[model samples]
Target: MNQIDFITEIQKHEPKMFGLAISILKNRDLAKDGLQESAIKLWNQRDYFQKVKNKQAYCMQIIKNWCYDELKRKVNNHLRLQDDEEVEEGIGNEKDHVNDTYRRIKSLIEKLPSKQRLIIQLKDFEGLDFEEISNALKMEQGSVRVNLSRARKRLKEMYLEQENKIKMIQNEE
Candidate 1:
């Protein structure tokens, strides 16, 4: 891609990178820093983009790596701030259900092994095909699909269990 194409690519994916970062880091400021670093890294390797079969996926992989690094750094540094916060307070009541679901999903995602979580996020949330995810992850296609499927199944079970517990609690109430 050329100069204009590169700018457009950045514009298209900037939000996704930021969102993914925030999902993993749970801090807006830290997410922004990770996005900035990813953008800089992409810029430095602009020429290498031509060789990539899927640039967006490649950039997303970069962002994913940065997020994992940030997560490790924060935990290793022993930060006391709770990872969960009430950031959805401004979304209004109408979106509360969806936001709650997302928060629950994020919590589930957090519990996943990093490899499984990465596969699920790339395949499910990001809407990438197996081949694309495999290429981005540098893994075989079958491995990517297996990981994604397992992650989704586990998350589904977890959500169902949580739902049942909530229902039981409500009945008790």
Candidate 2:
């Protein structure tokens, strides 16, 4: 494919790519950087493109790897981003408050095991169909469904449990 075609192909998948990146990175700025990096990597490896049978899959693989590396780097550096912390702390009283349901959802999502979190984010928030989610995560469609269900179930349980605990405290007071 020529440069224009290559650009077009990547652009076609841009929305999905951005969603995947944000889900993985959990930071808009970082996700944008990761997406840019993915495109740059694809461009650099363009000569080998023909060797890969599925360009979309190949680009996804690249993004996944880059996200992993970026996450690793963040962990190693012990980056404590204030925004995520605020969300986690339920401090939505400010102008940036995302609302109770979404806040609870985000809280539960953040508490999920890494794999489950990613699955839920892709399926619930990004609106990737089962097949697309499976393809992106390299899990089977059934597995994706099961994982997503479990994630939602767990979130529901946690929310109810936490709500009860708060009620108990309030009653005691």
Candidate 3:
């Protein structure tokens, strides 16, 4: 496609690209940096777009790689740190049961294995199909399906375990 067409197509999926970056990085600033870098890379490599079967999947793959690289750099540099203030802000409105539930689920998701977490995020949160996920992650389609299934099963089990624990605590009370 031409520059205008490419820019237009990319604009359509920019939000999703940024969302995926944010989900992986867990820091808005880092996610924005990743997105910007990915966008620039995409623009520079626009020629490859003609050969790509799925543009969105290709773009996502770029963003995912950038986030993974950033994560690795952080790990190597020992730069990873949780922002307690951010977590505290999120929990401020404890009266909102829905928000509490959301936070619990989010925490559970963060506990999942990295591969399972990415699969769950891509398939469930980003609403990508098996083909897209496989392409983006460079995995076989069957592997992608299996990973997603296992992730969902694990998440369900964790949720049930937490529910049971809550019930037990309530009963004790």
Whole-structure CA lDDT of model 1: 0.77
Which residue pairs collide in model 1, if any? Answer: none
Each model's TM-score, in the order given?
0.74, 0.76, 0.84
Best by TM-score: 3
Better of 2 and 3 by TM-score: 3
User: Which candidate has the top score in lDDT?
Assistant: 3
Of the candidates numbered 1 and 2, which has the greater TM-score value? 2
lDDT at 18, model 1: 66
Candidate 1 residue-wise lDDT, 31-141, digit = tens? 788888998888789889767877767877898799888777867998653565654666888898999888789778878887788777666776667876676567899
- Mark the regions of model 2 whose C-alpha exceeds 4 Å error after superposition: 47-54, 75-98, 169-173
Residue by residue across 1-173, what tens digits does model 3's lDDT show?
Answer: 68898789889778778767867887778888888898889888888876787788888889989989999998999997442225324445655687767678778888899788888987887787888778778899999888888989999999999999999999999
lDDT for predicted candidate 3 compared with the true structure: 0.82
Q: What lDDT does each candidate get? A: 0.77, 0.80, 0.82
**TM-score of candidate 2 relative to the true fold:** 0.76
